[model samples]
Target: MSSLCLLALNHSAQADEAPLTLPTGTISAPALDTQDISLQTPTSAGSRLGLSALETPASTESLSGERIRQRGDRSVQDAVSRSTGISRTGTPGDGGTSLSARGFTGQGSVMQLYDGNRLYSGMGTVTFPVDTWSVERLDVLRGPASVLYGEGATGAVVNVIPKKPFTGEIENHLRLGYGSYDSQQQALDSGGSLNDTLSYRLSLNRLRSNGWIDRGDSTSDFISAALRWQATDDLAFTLAHDYGDQQPMNYFGTPLVNGRFHEGLRDKNYNIGNDKQHYNDQWTRLTSEWQLSDSVSASNELYYLKAQRRWQNAENYNWDTAGQQLLRSGNFAIKHQQEQVGDRQTFTFKHSLFGLDSQTLTGVDYNRIRFQLNSNSPFNDALPDGQPLDLQHPDKGRFDSASAYRAQFQSTTKQMSVFAENRTQLSERWSLVTGIRRDYVQVDRDDLVDGSQSDKTLTGNNWKAGLVFALTPDTSFYGQYATSTDGVGGLISLSPSQQQYDLARARQSEIGLKQVFWDQRGEWTLAAYHIVKKKLLTDDPGNPTLKQQVGQQSSRGLEASLELQLPHAWQLQANAAIVKAQYDDFEEQVDNQFVSRSGNRPVDVPRRTANLWLNKAVTDKLRAGAGVRYVDARYADLANRNELPSYTVVDAVLSWKALRNTTFGLQLNNLFDRQYAQSQYNEGQQWILGEPRSFFVTADYTF
Candidate 1:
């Protein structure tokens, strides 16, 4: 179903272009899809200078909307999974968009953002399966980026760029699609200027489906809008808003039998009938820019985000061999309500620093977040004869009783940061890049269970330096060392004792080569890195009441990627990575005694990963594409007791230009119907089944 949205992306795509007029009043951004999809000649991923990807010293990649739509991606995960080294680490629903990268995973390491604003779930919460229809481009920076974004990005940062109002002739797009699992999709995009001083953009999408699992149904809608005002030649203002209401796939996961999957029960769901799970979010932002002078510029942004989530279901399950039945033990009803408000001010200038050509960016940011959670389990009876429900025939209504929580908890986080980065040209062929950031974080939590409270305040600093040398006009070599930090208890809450725990710290060093080959249409990057993470929290062996922060983790790895624009309108892209990650010095209290877990690999982290994709225009009217994704085996738990075997999936797409503005297409996912778990936890005892082979057809029109 992914590629169907691209049915009309032929040579005559000018009618679909959506150019955005910038707040700077004099600048405009052409539809990114019209540019080279691979090189991304202009981007803000690694630098605010608008440097080409080839010049950005970091390992960064950007994919245009056209490229993502061509692959028929529906969610943020869909687009990220195609990138090399990035492995899906959790379900898309629940904002469970955890990703494994570099040598770490989760919210404390890998970060995700909407636009340039960090979704700071601080407590491992991520925004839900954000529909791709609202994304204009995705930029990924695969290493420490704390200098740009404050804290917690030792692994990587994924920035989702949304569609903004652009100055252009009126253009609109409509797409309709249907797929396996009884899925339906409809989307609309409209953007243009009302006049020379005012322009607007709006995107809307509606989706529904009966999921792959029995009785698993889902419905979702997303809407985004932006209004831009070019009040004068020196200043401008813009406002944006986003809303999402979702009922994601109801299937939690299937339980394993005898420590292994049972193929016959693959389509079964353990949730109760009439169960409920839903998420809703609303966001608003205001931004303004002023060109104070030719050598100076300033900008400011303010935003607010609110979200609510609910879950009611029979969430945990396992097979009872002796009883010859399916054992379900947990019924949970939980709710989360969170809100965030923030502001940022930035100043940039171009000048001669110490007689060297230099470009500088300095910014200050402040953010405040309020979060709360409530839950209740009404049934103390583990098995009202439902303990071992008959596997052959589960009572459709046996576990239908609703849940009620006895209490509610509250938490709040406040943070402020000041950061500065300068790029100085040391010479015609050499450049120096340096930046630093200092952050002050405060957190307060109320434990309703005991009517107790805990609060903590911490501060940390991060910095990075890099040296770049241009060996030739089309080739370059670079080396960099960067540092960052992780919260003592992730970003949300901290253990009572750890309230004083120093934030975990991390540092990484890397060397890489960036080159343009096969003329200007191709590029290749090779990089190697060593990273160390320390101050991991663990219980004190000598004193059970105390906690220690001596644990450490390390990883060394190599990554390579090649992108080529081949002859005859063909394009090829391939990337792969191999890493050796280990818990260098980790210990835990087992059976009231300390036990070593020094050599185990981090859970859900694969040692190797790779992806390959190819697209060809067989004729001016037809286009075809194929891709393959591979992930090596990984541990599901910290003890390494359970292993999730490796898997490879194949996907294909074919599209036809049926008319001047209309296109039709078909997409096949998991072409071989591969049976594999996307990821696993709970000691590999529970399996999150991967999507099965599915098909979809789509039609698109422009007006």
Candidate 2:
């Protein structure tokens, strides 16, 4: 665990205004026996006060690893995009796999966190923590999370929490599986108490696949290990490390034939035979917590991260009707090497304020990131116009270059932040939660090709306030308002031209209701929110020849989720969201001229998304489950002229206990073999199709 928030809270019940003593004596680990009941579970990503999902006064979802496996979700993206108000917009191998939430899109808006620490993207790309095998749970907070995190989180924050060490009987878990397209998966997890005051946990996973498309083979490996020591009754320390190495599929997307899908070309691979994409990452963290007194506690975390990524391929393809060939462009080779170090310290106070119970938290965070890039752009090495191949049958030629890759750029980013949060019980039926955060960021860039340099310093201030009212012992209503910010582009890779603009600013207002009924058998939540963003760079309205930061965009949406455990050993889970997203004032440069895009929906921002899952226990050792997912149509370009059609897919799973400590399962994905675009590239000219019907057989054992 990278955060001390895992220390469970201890409330005083002597009186309504009794002082509370938040304890840090024992670690709080989630039980692996249950798959539901997230409403009552505490999440560190949602709040620093150790509040449960229902008490956070915001929309949060906690999906356990067991629940995800039962649903047959293999990738982190597959599990996270199923939550309310979220949809995928890119692929992991494309240097970045981004998402759209509320009204915001891309890596510059939605952030990713591993073990409660940010994975700073070098150039708008995040390629670590891709697999879900090592994850314990995923905590999602939707809409304007800058008050809890920091900048670049106007859309949402997805926290990937790995399994942690626990003091108990030694246990070991092993899983092996085989799926369609010659895919194989293997995983192992072991943990236990090594001594009276020490515990250790380790996880390993490997995956290999001969993908559904031609020449699309991929492999990945992940390892995580942790050790925990309780020095005294009031102090504890934990050290953890994670490593990942991946070689993702070399396929980009299929080019459209006459601006439409061609079923005949769905399985074609139109790139050099040696196309490559690789990512390697390492992360290490040490965390310590001390209970200074009954009413005071402190914790600190120190961490380091390193990442290396490389790509070489023909990324874009254009159809040539007359010539009966496909013209490929954007042929490039690029590399990124990044290193980061950071530390976070927090102090917590639990006492009475104005004769009411109050919990206050203050924290300071600092991190420095260094990044370097190497690439062969402008095609100075031959093949400047790109390669053309026959439409029907083509020779997959080898990658040929006359010169070696050259240094492109190197940059450094330093940031410091201070934040405070407080939760107070105003009365028996009402409470207030508020937080404030400020960040100072500095970015410096050097262009190796031209010997150009640029530097910029930015400051961001964020705050949020909310009120929660207990309508009943099992129901609550809440409302909140928050502010956030996003850089115009990836901060670490900011170019000289982009350094002239300030970070975009955004604000959001939300209201929600949560309830648990039917004797803990059912739970539901509903939320509605509106967000507005300004300072977007756009063409000057008076003079279309110039650009200015006077543009605006907004979105309003409603989201709902429900989970129920019915009679006769049946379970149901469902969620849906609808959004109205539009640009109030925006423009794009086309053919050296600016065109207004006001009132246009942002590209890849779907208006509606929904998911439903149902499971039944047929016998003491047998179970069955099925799920459905739907995504509405979306515009593929700012002009709103190209549209990607809506799609729906279904999946099913069955499991049987074959032994006392072993289980066998079968999973069928894309049950209907629905043919639809999962993502797009080259301004929607190319479409990455979704997987066809596939099946897998898996065995899981625990000892």
Candidate 3:
């Protein structure tokens, strides 16, 4: 349930003084209710037109920070997985923040944004905004999104809405926690009016853990602060800054022995003893909104971001059955430095179109990005066939690579886009919504090692049309068709071979029903969609050594969710999705031959997934909740030679209000001690083990 309203009023007065006159500007508040799961809440992720989830023609959902905390979701990825048709596909290389949705995997298909601004992936990786302490709510749009964003959003969009400042009485919050594996958490937040015309907010959080796996240590620190200034009755401005530093767990995955997982090896860390993985990010933005008139409004945002990341470790491992040992290779040291600057301006108007009530919006966006990469490539400086280590009694060695890292490549990208959206009421029971977007992208790449440079120019057009009909005052039926585009991987870090290919094109058709029943005590939604993507790069049949952009992939699926507030203080929420994802026309190179994989499922895609959560208030001061999640088996390779098994996990939480402004909680995760794999590496040769059973005790205080 989300309780963040789109419109709120604030008194522009100091604590010791009264306002000179009534203010006309509005202030948006964060979602503070843990039990308010209503689709009627307005969200920006689904449509820039300010449509609520129940009114949008696509599948959308919102999860509030308070709700996420009550459910014991510690990370952004874990919190997002609670939504429908979404799953985690994170790895060390991607900063453990990547996701898979709508049968599409990786950052290329599923785009991530912060405060409505995207932080482009450098090398198919995103490492910032992984912490949820600063998040107010998470908005998700689970379908073709290129019509709203730009290319590389063919699957879904996730927007992280940070907490903002509001003019009110002074308030502060503090939280502390201790959990299994020597894990600890500390967080603090404060916000209030600094003056009659200014309000501010600041948040700080730190997390540290000695992970379940041997030698697995991790730490993360984050700071977020903002200031809001009300310049006039109809105008306002806000400036915000955020910074993050992280050192993720060094363990990559456990090598499979003889093509099978061994429970005894699940806790082993296969990486070098002194493995290094770090990420640092900084973001700054200035936003302004002006209510020009009763029928017109304008808004603008300018933002800048800087990021640095580094990784050094043995990333891959394979079991040597003949020698009864493990082979470790793929050793490399890599670094990335990136900077981005962008601005967005939008104008909205309310008027009559063809004698009907209508609202329209027009916007322009421009961005420039610069990135540089440093790495040790080719692996020629390492021992051949990999260095062998004992399987049972291994000694984790230091990172002693003979090759030295050097500047490899640098890239500059300039992107420009123009978009528009319109919604009109055709009749008392019918409405229409339409949108269009055009994007121009230019990329220049320099091969520093070879002292050669090349550039490419690309253009993409996207559009969507949707129809909504009111079956009853409480139920609505909608249908839509949308088109999108996506790059092979990260556009800025395209390799020489990848740069030669064009972007892929995709289309989707969807229909859904939204209804609120049981006298507004229950709500349910159902949606069905089919998507097809073309121009995928695949092996050329005429020439096995070359590639052609003529392959195709498709997926069809059904998604459903239900939330009910029953009697006896019991509340229930459930969601399920079934997807049939496969390569429609494709070929893969295997054993020096082009093999047809037209009918096989894509790697790392689950066919079935479901979640169920139930909460009950035993008394006015005590509450308990339980949840269950299940994921179906998934193939790990193009040929479908290796399959990962299905798994189910359970979590429970209990909290008691000990004081007027304080609460204590006890949370237990993976109650059954289920041993499951979260992700795979090297074509199923290894599996990243999920966290084992753990428990935490926490205290939260507000003043």
**After superposition, candidate 1 runs with Cα above 4 Å error:** 1-25, 29-35, 92-94, 321-324, 377-386, 397-404, 495-498
For model 2, the stretches where C-alpha displacement exceeds 4 angstroms are 1-19, 23-34, 92-96, 322-324, 379-385, 400-404, 540-546
Query: 1-703, model 2: which lDDT tens digit per residue?
Result: 1011222332333236545676535644334434654688887777988888778888999898888878888877789988887888876443546888997888888888998999788778998785888888888999998987888998899998888888788899999999998999999999888988888889999999998888889999999999889888788899999999998877788889878888788778887787879999999999998888888899999999999999887777887777766877666788999999999999988876645677889999999999999988554535655578776665577665655679989999999999888888889989888888999999999999999999999899999988889888789999999999998888888878778888899999999999999998999999999999999988765675566988999999999999999999999999999999999999888776778899999988999999999999999999999999998988889999988899999999999998999999999999998888887888788888888899999999999
RMSD, every candidate, angstroms: 8.2, 3.9, 6.1
The list of candidate 3 runs beyond 4 A from truth reads 1-37
Give the backbone clash total of model 2.
0
lDDT of 3 by residue, 160-242 (tens): 88888877787898999999999999999888888877888898999999999888899999999998898876788999999
Residue 316 local lDDT, model 3? 82
Model 1, range 1-703, lDDT digits (tens) per residue?
A: 1111121242134324432222344744335243255544666667655666666677888877777888877778778978868898875333657888997988778878787888677346676536888888888888887878877788998888888888878889899999999999999999988899888889999999999988878889999999889888777898999999988887767788877777777787776786777889898999888878766788899999898888777766777777766877667666778889999999876665544566677889999988887777444534544455555566555444344576566889899999877777789889877777899989898888788998888888988888788888788888988898877655664556668788888999999998887778889999899999999887788888787899999998999999888999998999999999999988877788888889999988899999999999999999999999999999987788888889999999999999999999899999999988887645577778788899989999989
Model 3 clash pairs are 1-36, 1-37
Better of 1 and 2 by TM-score: 2
Model 1 misses residue 462 by how many Å? 0.3
